[model samples]
Target: MADDQLGEEYTCRVCGFRYDTPTWDGGSGSHDICLCCGTQFGYQDTVLDGVWSVRAKWAAEGHQWSSPEFRPPDWEPGTQLAQVPDRWADASVLAFKLSAPPLPAMRTSADPEAQRAEVLGRFLRDGRLTHFPATGREWTIVLEHIAAGFEPGVKYRRLEIDKLLKAWHGKPADLLSRLTDQGFVANDDQYYWRAER
Candidate 1:
């Protein structure tokens, strides 16, 4: 069968486990319980606060897989937790061993931004954004890179801006909005220009 034959995998909001079935759907819970964190979508996780409450309890209990029988022999908690969406990424989960590796000491010697750029580069295809990153900083870096194509101090008509952004992304409206909203570009009703650095 083709890859498309496989349905989309949905992530558990509480523990970031990806399951074949939908736990929450169209503003309603499927009530499918997570095998990892034991979150019952329609029951215990009806609200975001409740989801975090369950996650906190699960973490306190050593982050054990709720359904050991369903867990793979090589299941790694840290690796699974990394899939949590940035919107729901819990700092408490970092107390577990799955957190990112510590940065090298000596802040001046180690360039964290460069390291992040290297990782972000993987999401690009031939200098065009393949998709936006979840984290704000990484997302900003991508927008900055795209915005750099515009020459500073040169005003561009809306059509020109659209054409320029289309070269970097298939849908440029949202990207253009973010660029102006974030001060990477300055614009009036009819014209836009790269913001002075």
Candidate 2:
């Protein structure tokens, strides 16, 4: 017989254990052994009263699709075929497991802008910056802490500003653009300085 002509599912008759399809080497290995008990499987021993052949059993159950049915049932208008594999787990549990994500720690700050700045400043002050990290107030309120850190009458290089934001994993160019647009910071191609009043 050809590989495609075999029954995709089989059972261990001794222990009534169910065997799944595609057992490694396509369907050939599916019925070769009982996985639960390690018992050597013998398909011929399963035949009862000379009526159980793999092809014949599957065909009688309307499963073997390769050959035409030798005994297809006579059906009336409303006759229903019996359902196979009667019980299985609900899919919702599997779907939930697939879709769920791990939760992050909850924050309680009421001010959205303040909260964003706090989160943004965390990596900035973790000793990851050569510009020196300011903790406490700086970690809670970013813009003021950053502005105070800038020296008066001193032009800060764009590279320094880049290092500042890069320490926090922020895009330096984008932050400069946003700051300039808000009229609270001024910058050219090479330098940035606080325009605080």
Candidate 3:
């Protein structure tokens, strides 16, 4: 029989487990298992089955195209399609494992501005910035603590500048004014920080 005429057959090369056009409970296209070893194959593209006679041609044109980084090459004819050898299967599994990117290292900080920048940089790098909601004074406080090298997931009270100014009889404001005059601090929003330009 020509390969094109063959219908979909889920055959394990190891134990010779076979199923034909089986309805999978999960939407994912994974195979059930090997009849002999009972090892499960996650998923296979159903549309590509029997599209070509030679396994090599199917692998090159279909499998590789479907998953460029992880798909295994097609099995050769006369090769047992039922049960995959452990050694070869292990290599294919390793290839799939290596395809994922590594996770980022945890950050430590206490200063708000520095912490905020670091957190923002991490989110930007990992494409996770969108997960963060809008920024506010609470976020600013968190950033301050992070800049100070405080660990994440800890809470702290917000600083009240008015109390400090009252204790110094307005001396702190005078010093800030001096710094502003010297171009050391840029007064933009209510918060003061070093001038960017």
Q: CA lDDT, every prediction?
A: 0.68, 0.39, 0.34
Put the candidates in lDDT order, highest first: 1, 2, 3
Query: Candidate 1: where are CA atoms >4 Å away?
Result: 1-13, 16-75, 78-109
Q: Provide the RMSD of all predictions against the true structure, rounded to 1 decimal.
A: 14.1, 25.6, 21.8
What digit string (tens of lDDT, one per residue) describes model 1 on residues 46-100? 5667767887888789888665545666666666666655545577654442554
Candidate whose TM-score is highest: 1
Please name the candidate that would achieve the greatest lDDT relative to the true structure: 1
Off by over 4 Å in 2: 1-140, 188-190
- Candidate 1 lDDT for residue 114: 76
> Looking at candidate 2, what is the lDDT of residue 101?
40
Residue-by-residue lDDT tens digits, candidate 3, 1-197: 54312322343322222333331334443443322233334433222232112233433453222212211243321233313223223333234333433212212356867766665653333322222211223233323322233223333222333333224333445434543554544444555554432
User: Model 2 Cα displacement at 20 (Å)?
Assistant: 58
**Clashing residue pairs, backbone N/CA/C < 3 A, model 2:** none
**Could you estimate the TM-score for every candidate?**
0.50, 0.28, 0.17
Tens-digit per-residue lDDT, 1-197, candidate 2: 53313322343332222333322243233234433223334433234322124323433455322212211233211111111111211232233334434222212368878666654544355633223222222232444444555676667787887776565445567555545654546777777887766
lDDT of 3 at 146: 24
- Measured with C-alpha atoms, the lDDT of residue 55 in candidate 1 is 79
Q: How accurate is candidate 2 locally (lDDT)?
A: 0.39
